[model samples]
Structures are given as structure tokens and as C-alpha cells.
Target: MKIAILGTRGIPNYYGGFEQFAEFFSVYLAEKGHDVYCYNSHNHKYQEKTFHGVNLIHKHDPEYKFGTFGQFIYDFNCIMDSRKRNFDIILQLGYTSNSVWFFLMPKKSINIINMDGLEWKRSKYSKPVQQFLKLAEWLAAKSGDYLVSDSLGIKKFLLEKYKKESTYIAYGAYPFNSPNEDILKEYQVEKENFNMIMARFEPENNLDMVLEGVALNSEDKTPILVVGNHNTKYGEYLKNKFKPHENIRFMGGIYNLQHLNNLRYYSKLYFHGHSVGGTNPSLLEAMASQALIAAHNNDFNKGVLKENAFYFSNPTEVKNLLNNSKKSNNLPFIKNNYEAIVNEFNWTKINGDYLQLFEQCMERYKAGKSK
Candidate 1:
């Protein structure tokens, strides 16, 4: 089968979650003898023509110059190109900018959209922007031939709100095997002596509240490194607000998976504050890395973690968890999470599931056309 992947910054995963999955999934499909094309921004650092047997389609992305609006131009370019490619399926990773171009998508191919978190509920966007995102979500749900929900919570929400039934395919993770404990030395922390957060500096991610908890518990004084790009306005705000707390170290975005996994493995507690819908790739990676997770209290996190994680809805809860966390209590949760990664969220399983879904889409699409 010939497939085209749109809606990411292209593979080798220099960026974030979608690109990471696209890199892994596309390479897997290519190895399985399927023709795969992953679209990359023209400005993406890895400008090669192909990556690991998968075809690379480079399109002009103006996001650097025009900000968020530039993503629309990039998606438009990808959509226009797909019209000529004769792909069997087009897997759009998200609908933020691409849903508007649903009309232009190739009619012969089946469209499968991975409905990411509920963007409209994010606190960063204004009311008007939120409304626009809702409209985009509705458009994507209505126009897509198939839809994928990464979490059961999101799947339930889609059914309830849009009456759209989607396949529930959560993100995948690989167990962190090569743990270089020395990586902790480079980050200026001892094993199990530091706490960490590996999310973007967004309001909805509950970063401020998490940091507040770390600050309130000053007696422990274990460094809680915040890993992400902190150049944004919100990042600066966080830095300023938490400046007095010496324990909160803002370690700007560390892309190397080996380094990140090592950090998570050695950390005393890993905080996942993403309140967005669906399963988060970082949360999965933290599990695979055997981190003792204290996640934001939400249906999505609870659904995945179940009894394997500590839950927190506010700074007070975060404080309580941090103040009393012990090695004995954390070990079993870490072990169970690692097993979950190997058995449930493994990349091998994820690749197979996505391939099966694509094949099913083809069968259903052809049958509909014949009728």
C-alpha cells in the first residue's frame, strides 16, 4: 500500500511527538514493503530526500516567519501535492490547520485523522481562537473518512460531542534499555534525588501549579528540572514566577531520547501535567523509562496509569506526593509501567495496529466506491 503522512515537521524526530511517531511508524511501514511518504517542512534540519527506505516529501513551511498562520500554508502545500501522488491513504496527524483543506484532499484516497487533544479547551488560545479550533475539530470529524483517538477519554468525548466513532489507537513507546546513569551527572543531579517535567511551557499543561508544589516543599530541595523550550512568553513567565525557588531548574528542550530517558529513569519523580485529551507520548516514554509518575488528575492519565501512578489535581496534591514519595512505594509502579510499555504500548504493536487500520480503510473505501 502507498501511504502519505502529513501534519508533522517530518521525521528523524528533531521536533515533538507527532514527528517522533511518524519517524517510527513510517520507517516500520517502509520495512514491511509498503510505499510510505512523510511530508517535511522545507526548513526542517534533516533535508535529505529519503529517510530509512521511506520517501521524503519536502514542502515549503512558512511557520518561522508567519507564526501559527504559516502552518496553514504548509498543510495547504502538502494537500496540493497529495492530489497528484495517487496515495492509497493519507494519514493526517492532526487537524489544527489541515481540516480547512478537507475539500482539496484526493477523493480517491481514504483520509485518516489522528484527533489529538481537545485544542479548544487550552487556556493559551483566546475565546475566538478556541471557537475556531472547535469549528476545525467539527470539520475534521465530519470530513474525515476515518478517525483515530489516542485515548479512550478522547474517543468517548468524540462520540458524545460530535457523534463520531473513531478507532482507539493510543501512542506507543520503547523501553529505555541503555540507561547511562552518567547522564544524571551531566545534568547536575544524583540518581533518585531530582524530580522532572518534560512538557512544553503551556498554561493548560499545569506547569505553574507543578512548580508551585516544588517551591512549597523547600525542605527536600531536590532539583526539579523543567525540560522544554523556555523561550516563549509563558516560559519567561514561569521562570520569573518561580525564580525565587532555587530547586526549579529550567533545562531547555533536550531532544536526544537517550539523554531524556536516562534523566527520567534516574529522577525521583516524573511529573506529567498534560490535561489535554488522549494519551501523551511523553507520558508513555516516562512509563517506559520506569519513572514514578505523578500525573495531572484526568480521565486520560487515570485510564492509562490506573493503579500504577500518583495522581494530583493541584499544587497541594503535588506537594503531598513529593513530600512523602519513597523508593519502596515507587519501585512497583515503575516496574508495572515498564511492563505496560512492553506489552501494551510497544512500537511493534503500534505499527501493526496502524497497518491493519490502513488495510481496513482501503477495503471499506473500495467497497463504498463500488456501491
Candidate 2:
């Protein structure tokens, strides 16, 4: 199959979850003898023409200059290039900016869109932008040849909202086997001696709420580490608000996978505050690292963690969890989460699932053409 993956900044995962998915899935597809192409932003750090066996196509992305609006231009460029490729499958990772060009998609290609999450529900966007996003979601659902959902919750959503049946294919993660305890010394923390949360500082993510929980539980004196870039306006505000809590340490954006894995493995309790996404990569990584998780109380997180994680709905719940954390036996939760990664959420299985879905789509397409 000739497949082109778009909607991410690029492969080799310089950015977020979808980029990570692109990097792994593209390489896997390439290794399986399918001609796979991953589109990259012209400004992406990795300027190479190929990664592993996967082909890389670089297009101009002016997000640096025009901010969020630049994404629309980038998606347009990618779609324009994709029309020339004559791909068998065009795997769009998200539809936030790309749905507008659905009309321009290659005629010969079967477009399979990964309906990411309830993106319109994000608190970051204004009312108009959110409404626009909802329209885009509908457009992508109507336009795509098939839809893929990363979680069962999202699949149910598509079914209820658009009467569309979407294939549920969650993101993947590998189990963390290498644990270097010495790395903790650099951060002035000991193994399981501190709590931690790693997420983009966003309102919807409930980063502030998580911090507030820590602040409310301040008397317990359990040190908590806040990881991710604190350079954003919201991030800075969080820093200033939480600075008075001496137990809370804000570690800026960390790019190293090994370091992140190590941190997750060593942390006493890992808080996952992402409230909107479906099968977020970070949540899987935390589970893989055997981190004791306290995720946001939502269908998305609950669907992934099930009864295997500690669920928190608000700052009060977070406070209560931290206060009694030591009394909780984390072994069963750790065991269950690790098994999930190994058995279900591993990259090999996920890549195979994609292959199976693509083959099914191809068969259906062929049947339609024969008719």
C-alpha cells in the first residue's frame, strides 16, 4: 500500500503524541514493504528526506510566524502535495486544520482520518474557534472514506454524533525496562520520594487544578515535580501562583525519552491531568514506566486505565489521594498497567492493527470499484 501520513509537524517525534504515532507507524509500515510517506514541516528539526525506511516529505510551515493560523496554510500545502502522490491510503492524524481541504484530497486515495478527540471542547480556543472546530469535525467525518478513533469513548462519540462507525485503534507505548536510579541525583530527588506530573500547561488539561491540589495538600509535605514547558503565558502564571509551595518544583520541557521514562519510573505518584484526549501517549508512557497514576476523571482516561488507576475529578480529589497515597498498595495497579502495554498497547500490535484496518478499507474500495 502506498500510504501518506499527514497532520503532524513531522516524524522522529519532535512534538506531541500524533507525531510519535506517525514516527512509529510510518517506520513500521515501511518495514512491512508498504511505501509509507510522512509529511514534515519545513522547519522541523529533523530535515532529513527519510527516517528509518519511511520517506519524508517536507512542506513549508509558517506556524513560527503566523501562530495557530499558520497550521491551516501548512495543511493546505501538505494536501496539495498529497494530491500528486496518487496514494492508496491517506492517513490523516487529525482534522483540526486539514478538514477544510477535504475537497482537494486525491481522487484515487482512500482517506482514513483519525478522529483525535473532542478537540472543540478544549478551553484554550474561544467560542468562535471552538464552533469552527466543531464544523471541521463534521466536515472530516462526512468527507473521509473511513474514520479511526483512538479510544472507545471517541468511537462511541462519532457513532452518536454523526452516526459514523469508527474503528477504535488506541495509541501505543513500550514497557520501560531500563531504570537508571542515578539520574534522580541530578534533579535532587530520590526514587519514589516525590510526586510528578508531565503535561502541557493547558487549562483543559487541568494543570492548575493539579497544582492547586498539591497546594491544598501542602501540609503533607510530599514534594511534587511539575514537568513540561513553563514558558507559556499560562505556564508562567502557574509558576507564579504555585511558587509559594516549596514542595512543588517546576521542571521545564524535557525532550529526552530516556530521561522522561526514568523520571516516570522513579516518581512516587504520576498525575495525568489531560481531560480531553483519547489514549494520550503520555498516559501510556506513565503506565509503561510503572508509575502510580492519578488521572483526570473522564471517560477517555478511565477507558484506558479502567480500574487500574487512581481517578481524580477535582483539586479536592487530588488532595485526598496524595494525603493517603502511602497507605495504598500500588503493586497491583503497576502490574495491570504494565501488562496492558505489553499485551495491548505495544507498538508492534498497534502497527499491525493499522495494517489490518487499511487492508479492510482496501478490500471495501476494491469491491465498490468492481460494482
Which candidate leads the pack in TM-score? 2
Runs off by more than 4 Å, candidate 1: none
State the lDDT at 201 in candidate 1: 84
Q: lDDT score of model 2?
A: 0.91
lDDT of each: 0.92, 0.91
Candidate 2 regions exceeding 4 Å error are none
Report the C-alpha displacement of residue 54, candidate 1, in angstroms.
1.5
Model 2 lDDT at residue 348: 94
C-alpha RMSD of candidate 2: 1.4
C-alpha lDDT (0 to 100) for residue 199 of candidate 2? 88
The Cα RMSD in angstroms, rounded to one decimal, for candidate 1 relative to the true structure is 1.5
What is the clash count of model 2?
Answer: 0
